[model samples]
Every structure is written in C-alpha cells, then in structure tokens.
Target: MIKAAESVGIRAEWVTCQNAGQLMKCDALFIHGTSSINHHTYRMARWAERERLAVMGDPQSIIRCTNKVYLAEILERAKIDTPATIVVPRGNAD
Candidate 1:
C-alpha cells in the first residue's frame, strides 16, 4: 500500500510495530487495514495520535474504517455514490 502511494510520488516508509520503540524523533505513522486492529496496534496508533503524528485513517473513530462495522455504515450511508451497498441484505435485512 505504501508502495502505491510512493508510486504516485508520496514519500512512504515501512516499519514494524516491534521496531517502533519511540515516536519522539519521528513525524508520522501509517497504519493500514489489518486482519484485526488488535490491542498492540491500537495502543501504538493512539500513542501516535497523542504525540500528534499524522495518521492516515484514525482508529479512534469507531475503529470502523479499520473496523469493518463502520465501513458498512459508511458505505450504506453513501449508497448513492456507492450503489452496490443499496442492495438489501439477506435474511430480514432492511
């Protein structure tokens, strides 16, 4: 993903959470979508926020984007722009 951005001329870096011991000397962080935005990831993301690091998509916002549930809501709400979600859900779905 960072590669995609860099391909478009956006400077990007890849760093593991284990290697991310401090943010005092850093500028920003990019936490991408993962299988589960678990405790450690969440902790690091939050710390980066408090330290004012520029986050691509904030997890604190209901963990939705990084959190699937919120993605559904956002998609549903923007169904006009994303008509695919306008389709009714299965089994008693509105």
Candidate 2:
C-alpha cells in the first residue's frame, strides 16, 4: 500500500500503536492488520480519531470489516463474491 501511494507521489509510512506519537505528525493514517476490534489497531484508530487525522480504514470500517459475519453481509449486499461462510455459536469450537 505504501508503494502504491508513493507511486502516486503520496509519501506514506507504516506505523503501529507503539509509534502512535509519530502518527500525530503524519498527514494521514492508513492502519493495517487490525484483525479484531480488541487489537491494538483499534487503539491507534481511536487515537487517530481524537487527533482528527484522516484514516484509510476508518474506525467504524475497521470494526465491521474485522468481523467475518458483518463483512460477509456487507459483501453479499454489494453482490461481491465471497467464499461460502457459516456463523457458528461461540461455544461450538469443534
């Protein structure tokens, strides 16, 4: 993503929750690897929000996209192809 941005003449850098301080100086924030709402990315996203910096995948987007059920529903509504999916109850680990 950074490479693609650089190609377009937008200098981009990857930062993490550990370097959130550095993010405050950036013009924009494009978070990656936010696998779950509980992940550190959420904290960074929230921080970005407070700072009012533009985020590539906004916090709400992160929340919905990180959950398979919500993402599948969104894809279905958009008529986007996705692998067959099922939502199992939390206790049914098997």
Candidate 3:
C-alpha cells in the first residue's frame, strides 16, 4: 500500500501504536488493522476525524459496523439483500 501510494506521488507511511502521534502530521489515515471501540485504532480514527484528516474506517463506521445487529438493521433499511439472519440477544442464546 505504501509503495502504491508513493508511486502515485501520494506520501504514505506506516504508523504503529507506539508512533501513532505521527498521525497529526498526516493528511489522511487508512487504518490497516482491526478496529474496535476498545482498541487504539478507534481512538486513532476519532483523533484523525477531530483533526479533519481524511479517514477510512472512521469512528462512526467502526461503531456501527462492529455491531452485527446494527449493521443488519442498516442493510435491511437500505433494502439491500442479505443472507437470512437471526439475532440472539445477550443471555438469550440457549
């Protein structure tokens, strides 16, 4: 991904949790790892959004997409066909 970006004249660098502060210096963020609300990736996404940097997998998306029930509802509301699904509420899976 870095090579492709640089080939097109777009600068891209890898940022890890240890050096996430570098996000402030980037014009965009492309999270290349799993994102969870309890994870640093989510924090990074939120920070990038607050800084107004283009962010793929933005915080809101991470929140909504991470919840299977919510994602199902969205797909249903949008009339997008999906495989048959059943949502088992917490503690009700017996």
Leading candidate by TM-score: 3
Candidate 2 vs candidate 3: the TM-score winner is 3
Per-residue alpha-carbon lDDT of candidate 1 for residues 5-76, written as tens digits (9 for 90 to 100): 789987666656777775555688776545246656667777788889886545565276554556767777
User: Please, what are the lDDT tens digits per residue for candidate 2 over residues 1-94?
Assistant: 8899999999888787667689868877887674467888887877788789997777888778777888888898899998897778899979
**Candidate 1's error at 82, in angstroms?**
6.9
RMSD of each: 4.9, 2.6, 1.3
TM-score of each: 0.56, 0.73, 0.89
Whole-model lDDT for model 3 versus the true structure?
A: 0.93
Task: Give the Cα lDDT of each candidate.
Answer: 0.65, 0.80, 0.93
Candidate 1: where are CA atoms >4 Å away? 1-12, 33-35, 80-94
Which stretches in model 3 have alpha-carbon errors above 4 Å? none
Off by more than 4 A, model 2: 1-3, 90-94
What is residue 15's positional error in candidate 1, in angstroms?
2.5
lDDT measured at residue 24 in model 2 versus the true structure, 0 to 100? 67
Better of 2 and 3 by lDDT: 3
C-alpha positional error of residue 33 in candidate 1 after TM-score superposition, expressed in Å: 5.0
The top-ranked prediction according to lDDT is 3
Which digits, one per residue and each the tens of the lDDT, describe model 3 over residues 1-94?
9999999999999988899999989999999888999999999999999999999989999999899999999899999999997899899999
